[model samples]
Structure formats: C-alpha cells, structure tokens
Target: MEKILVVSSNKTASETLLDFLRGSFKCTPKIVESAYQAKVHLNSDVLTELVMINSPLMDESGVEFAEYVTENTTANCILLIKAETAEKISERAEKAGVIIVGKPFSKAILYQIVRTVDIAVSRSVELYLRNARLEEKINEIQTIDKAKFMLMEYKSMTESEAHAYIEQYAMNKRKKKSIAALAIIDKLSEQYL
Candidate 1:
C-alpha cells in the first residue's frame, strides 16, 4: 500500500481528511500539524507516496512545504487553499509540479484527484525502477570490459583470448562471468599493476 502524509494545522480539517483517506483508500495516513513535523517525517527512511497539505499551516503557508516535497522527494504533493487564493498560488506551485486544489471541495472531487495522483505515482515508480536496473546492467558491462582490457594489455592476449579466458574461468569456478571478470581484474592488478 502507498504511504500518505497529511500536513494541516486545523484539527478538524486534518481529522476529516484522515477519515476520508482511510475510508476511501483503505490506507492510514500520517498526520502532522506543522510543516516542520512533516519535514522531519519526510527525512525518515520511509517512502511516502503522497503528501496532502492544507494551506496556511501554523509555521508557514503550505506552499513552501509542498514545493519542498515535490522538488526533493519522489512523492507527489497536493496543496489545498481557499478558492480566492488558489488561483494565485497555483501559478507558482504548478511550475514546481505541485497539484493545487481549491478549498470547499466535495469528497467526490478530492477522491478523483487522489486517485489520479495515485496512478501517476505508480507509473513514476515503475519507470524509476526500470531505469535503475538498466543502469546496473550497463555498469556491470563496463566492469567486464575493463577486466578484458586489462587482460589484453598486461597478459599480452588478444581481445578474443581475454573473452575466452574469462568465460572458461567462470565455467571452471562455477561463478558468474562478471564475478570471474572481477577476480581476474583483481589478480592481474595485484600481479602487474
């Protein structure tokens, strides 16, 4: 389940939001009365999927905190402000990728917006994981290549010979090709370099 963090100074509003989120989404959201508390929670290792801020927090207007969450974390943020001020705030908040919703909104509207943000966060996480895996694979390939180059230079072997040697070593040792390459690199570095 996705984790949610709610930042609101008003006790009544926070309770309402908490109930609505729990009932509608079947998830419990962590609530904080100030932006400072929210920041402390955010700094923890736990990953929050969504951050909902009721504007005019006791410590600061929620806009700065909303912007902080969007800029510094992977979490999606939604800022709720009075209808009169939402338009002005949206102009700046939207640029930071913060979703702005005017106050006096119905549960139905909030539900729809939350659902949409949930979908977007899910997709973003999938893409990020995919990219991380690709990067790991690329790094492994580069490491193997470096090992092969070392073999060619220090052992006076051709590229094909280095490749064959690493493959044969992995087969004989019952190890992965990358592990064998690393071993070869370490051995050669110790002996020659």
Candidate 2:
C-alpha cells in the first residue's frame, strides 16, 4: 500500500481532503496539522510515497515544506495553494519536482493530479530497481574477471582454463559463478599473498 501524508491546518479542509483521498485512493493517509508534525513523520524509516500539503498551514505557507519533501525524500508532493500564489510559485515548485495545484479545485482535478504523480512515482521506482540490479550484475562480472586474472597470473593457467575452472567449480558446488569466483580469489590470495 502507498503511504500518503496530508499536511493541513484547517479542520474543514483537512476533513474534506481526508474524505476525498480515502474515497478516491482507497488508502488511509496520515494527517498532520503543521509542517513540524509532518517532518516528524517523514523522518521516520517508513517510506511515504505521496505528500499532499494544503497551503497556509499553521506553521508556514507549506511551499517550503513541499520543497523540503522533494529534496529530502523520494515522495511526490502536491502543494495546494491559492490560484494567484500558485501561479507565482509554480515554476519554483516544479523545478524542485513538486506539483502545485490551485485551490478551489474540483475533486476530479485533484484525483487526476494524484493519479499522474502516482504513475510517475511508480515509474521512478521501477527504473531505480532496474538500475540497482544492473549495478549488481556489473560488480559480479568485475569480481569474476579479477578472479580469472589472478588464476592466469598466479596459477600459470590460460584464460580459457581459468574460465573453465571457475565454471566447473561453480557447477560442482551448485553455486553462482560470482560466488565461485570469490572463493577462488580468497584461496589464491591467501596462498600467494
């Protein structure tokens, strides 16, 4: 489930937002009356995917908090502000990756904005995971290459022989090629160095 945080000071606005978000997204959002409270929640280890801020929060205008969220967390932020102020700050907020929504917006508009942000967040996470896997694969390949080189230099084996040795060892032990490479490296290093 996506964790959402709503920061608003007005009782009526927060209640309306809670209802709309709960009804539309089918998720419960944590509501905080001030940026300070929101920060406390955000600082925790739990990952929050979305942050919706109603402008004129009791502590501040909420733009700063929106920027803070964008800078500090992976969560997508939507800042609801007066139409006039939104126009003035939209560029700045957008540069920081915060989506600005003008006040007096219909439930449909809010839903659309949230949906768009959700799609963006999902894509971003997918890309991040993909990149991490690629990096891990690259590291494993490098480790295997290093082990192969050590075998060629210290064991007086040809490149093909080193490769075959590692492959045979991995198959025999039912372990990954990288794990076998690491074991070879440890044994050769201990024996030679």
TM-score of 1: 0.92
Task: Give the candidate number with the greatest TM-score.
Answer: 2
lDDT of 2 by residue, 1-193 (tens): 3699999999899999999989988889999999999999999935999999999999999999999999998788999999999999988998999999998899999999998887887888899999999999999999999999999999999999999999999999999999999999999999999
Residue pairs of candidate 1 with colliding backbone atoms: none
lDDT over C-alpha atoms for residue 81 of model 1: 94
lDDT: worst 10-residue window of model 2 = 116-125
| lDDT of model 2, residue 142 | 98
Q: How accurate is candidate 1 locally (lDDT)?
A: 0.91
lDDT of 2 at 193: 96
Worst 10 residues of 1 by lDDT: 85-94
Model 2: clashing residue pairs?
A: none
lDDT of each: 0.91, 0.93
Off by over 4 Å in 2: none
